[model samples]
Target: MRELPEIRFLTSGDVTGAEKSTAETAVRSALAGAQGTVTAIRVTLSVVADPALPRPALAQAIVDVDGRRLRAQAAAPALPEAIELLRDRLSVRAAYLRAS
Candidate 1:
């Protein structure tokens, strides 16, 4: 069996848990954990802040595999949720990629 492909997490500003996008070793990790048959993957995160209102951070990950593409985004009270949601989306895609 082949190992999981890499996974990349890109961020704009200080996202609580995750540092700057591609900080530390995200690029390396993503390149290592991408199990999905995603021929290509794009992870982009933009920080949207409202002073009047405290809103949860939003996260989105877009995966391009062959002619099929999958996009996942989740708005959670915390940054972790956003990450998990995005991962779940990718996981589903990974499964599909592995199966087919």
Candidate 2:
């Protein structure tokens, strides 16, 4: 079995343990399609202090596959929504890269 790539999580504001864990799991699951090509993954999540913003939660990720890099970002009113959006974006990008 191929080993999973190293995943690093960075957070700002009131990020929770569950959010980080869920983000990690989502990234790992998405990378399954890309598998051995991945070298590392970095996930960043943050919550905006301002309450006026329509989308206060932000999530982004950078995936290093071999020597190539793939990136995705999303914003939502809730952290979980941003995480899921980022995960989906990453998954699509990974699959596209894997194909070519």
The candidate that wins on lDDT is 2
Q: Local distance difference test, per candidate?
A: 0.55, 0.89
Per-residue CA lDDT of model 2 for 1-100, tens digit only, reads 3577678888998999999999988888877778447777899999988999999999999988888999999999999999999989999998898789
| Predicted candidate 1 versus true structure: per-residue lDDT over 4-48, tens digit per residue | 335565676546444334321332233344444546556655456
Worst 10 residues of 2 by lDDT: 30-39
lDDT of 1 at 7: 50
Query: Any runs in candidate 2 off by more than 4 Å, and if so which?
Result: none
Give the per-residue Cα lDDT of candidate 2 at 23.
94
- Collision pairs in model 1: 5-33, 5-34, 5-35, 6-30, 6-31, 6-32, 6-33, 6-34, 7-30
Residue 80 CA displacement from its true place in model 2, Å: 0.3
